[model samples]
Target: MSITVNPDWWKTLFDEVYLMTDARSVCNEDITRLEVDVICELLPIRSQSKILDLCGGHGRHSLELCARGFSCCTLLDYSQVLIDYAKARAAECNLSIEAVQSDARSTGFPDESFDHVLIMGNSLGYIKGPADSQIMSEAFRLLRPGGWFLVDVTDKSAIKRDFNPEAWHEINDDTVVCRKREIKGDTIHAREMVLNKQKGLIRDQTYAIRLYGSQTLASLLEAAGFQQVTVRTGFSPHASKGNYGFMNNRMLATGRKM
Candidate 1:
């Protein structure tokens, strides 16, 4: 089937079904711990640092950080459902985390308000064109001098090496999701369909992600006024179940405000 990518698909794509479909990776505690470990190792952070989790759906990483004694952590995402879910989880767990529902491109935060900013879970490249730069600029604006900005994304090399056109997975006994992918220039256009045993076709959507090489990402970061940009590949979430999707092989692109 031919599918046209929607620029605003993400506005509704991260609902409850998304959590169910990506449960193994996004909701997995073990994998979250491992990813948090990598984040801590890659950046110089103290327990009291003020961190911003950009596009942080349901604030998984932020919650984990709070558990680890990182006191001031704020999560921002465009989805109201995810933000509310994160807030409830934080209250239930007695973890102190601030969750905000807002666009990543222009978060209404004061200048230099964060010690570090993170874009995790392969959340970048959601829209085509220069959106990445706008997000990075916001991250730059939020970070204090000497603050670090880290991005977790699928490695372009890995995707080129193992590009699968189609895949399917059983979410459970009642539901299944099928995916079809096509590469156009630097972007991967995808169509996802979710079906239930009794409900028939529940969800069908198309989205696009612009893949970036390490050098290209670094240059973008530099253009956003970040310096000392570095990229580390081979950083996998090591998820135990569900489709890895774009998280199959990941890279960390980090930069400094100064």
Candidate 2:
């Protein structure tokens, strides 16, 4: 078994089974609403505001915002599966949402095209080194003057206080997902295995993501040309069903283009 992860792990990690692995927070509509509520409070905007949901998987937050009468929202994600899922959900709910498949580092949007940009659901830090900073720079370029950029990420202190090496969760009566984690500098490398009672082994994969502390994240935003950067902690969301992983404790960082 290889402990190392593919640098392109993210390209294939968020497939259908990922919905099962992360069902508790991502699939739960109530949890999505609660999270969007916090987001709306942090960056209050008018209905006509043009918003971009970067790295928005399955458009969870975008869908919730549309249902709440926040139009003019576009969701961009690298996963085609998730983008299709988002489009289907929007159509089913009779809500208007634009779902696009694209990379966060280069969304190909016009400069200063959006009034607001968001990186919700701990979608940052997927790529190590300068990739995260490039994503932030893209966000800065996409935002208009005075536009707000908000990101949700794990709180490093909480990770230090609550790091577990190995854990398992029962996805259903016959399905289980097990995880093993190792820390490498500021990055966490994880291997996940999914097993089924009837079919036996389903999936075994390894992935890695860079973790950021509050101050470091704020500084990154500032370095990306954002002004008035602020970070608010204690944005934890409780799960009523499956595992939330690093989402157990998160911090919201906000900045302005100015």
Candidate 3:
């Protein structure tokens, strides 16, 4: 078996093209509101709850939570660009949110400080090797007793079953992005190319992400001292009832620190 090396492409990819490609899906006001509402239904959030948005790119979730009357919100992401953008947005909106640029594996926050933690947008597989476990451990350490930890990730089983080699998306009227994927062992290698009307070909990047099945992820969470772990599938708003199996494309994993 070959070892997986972390090139840490996220440090660069998230600067411009990433925002251009995903802004509509992640930063839209209506979508953010719906996602926040779903989270509210799943977690016991209160006005005074101290929530930490782990790996919260751009702080959309944190902003929505604060708008919903949750005063204590901290948004943490490794991308300084995204963090700075989120801070500016928060400042413009006159919302008091703490934005921190830090690695998720070691957040450096005090133990048992937050009431709830969120890791969304499938940001769990960025680090290689045992780092996933360390990320979970950090989440456990940051949450107080009875605190909820919510995670969203792509369903690896489904992706493996229906692996597509190439896909393309129109980022904007004049920009397009294409992605080609290859699965080697437990890691998925993605090569992304971006084309712009003005600049022609702009970016060509490659990255690797480890794929985790439901059982594997649950085991990691449990080993990290999280109890009552539950893994559900198909969290999209348009997903039908009972769309929560290996065939589903997305998974939502929840656990409580006790």
Candidate 4:
């Protein structure tokens, strides 16, 4: 019998220490660091504001916020490995942050628990199940009136124009990478793959993620009672796309719960 490895298995092999005091230094992985800076620019954070980093793998953002003096910073994700790494980082930094292993679709928390709920870094696409809409709805449920949620994903238009099987690349013996784009009815599909090579092929896996464009994301958030929803196309001032769904840098999505 042969076993098939997965893309998400890299986290299992690597020491995913995501949430340490020095997380920023650890996360200077170019793209990830750029994402962190962009979100901080968009958020109206204050010393007393409370924030929840949903699907906050390794608590990097949460820890950063905590360091910035947010009243309460919470990191929630279903990945225990990621959480453990985050916790280790928090301990080293001696920061008082809360990290929870919980599902984004159902946090089992009380209503209106956070002021700013963040689900970025393409986490929105990982929940490929019947409960995806439920996750968004539940995120809305966890917010108080006027709460904000920021989500990030690939631009559907970009993916449609540039996606292909040839987008994949192999970096080294320990890394095999690929990118793909597909469309399934109303939803657009974009994925990133990375493989870790072992002695032969025992160490191989892929990290696949999907994304929804502005229209679908806006409609879903609005249907869930989020008002004054705004789209940031990353390249525009005010983080607004000005009725144009096309832009660059990285997708910066911002919405408010009415």
Q: Whose lDDT is greatest here?
A: 1
Model 3, span 1-258: residue lDDT tens: 333334777677777567776665675677678778978988999999999999999999999999989999999999999999999999999999999999999998999999999997778776666888999999999999999999888788877877877777787799987877888977788777899999998888887887778999899889999999999875664344322222136678899998
Superposed model 2: Cα runs more than 4 Å off: 239-243
Residues 1-258 of candidate 4 have per-residue lDDT tens digits of 222335444334333422221232335444354556777787676677678888878787777777666749889888888888789988998887889988888898899998888886556654445555787788889887878878765566655554453354444456554544445544444344455566333322333345567787787677777777877663432233222111233456677887
Q: What order do candidates take by lDDT, descending?
A: 1, 2, 3, 4
lDDT of 2 by residue, 1-258 (tens): 437989899999998999998897788888888899988899967798999999999999998888888899999999999999999989999999999999999999999999999999888777866998999999999999999999999887877667787889888999999999888778888999999999998889999878889999999999999999999987878844224678768899999999
TM-scores for the candidates: 0.96, 0.96, 0.91, 0.74
Q: Candidate 1's residue-wise lDDT over 190-258, tens digit each?
A: 999999999999989889888988888889899999999999888777744334778768889999998
Go through the candidates in order and give each one's C-alpha lDDT: 0.90, 0.89, 0.83, 0.63
Q: What root-mean-square deviation over C-alphas does model 3 reach?
A: 3.6
lDDT of 2 at 100: 96
Candidate 2 clashes: the total is: 0
The RMSD of every model to the true structure, in order and in angstroms, is: 1.4, 1.6, 3.6, 6.5
Model 1 regions more than 4 Å off: 239-243
For candidate 3, give the lDDT. 0.83
Clashing residue pairs, backbone N/CA/C < 3 A, model 2: none
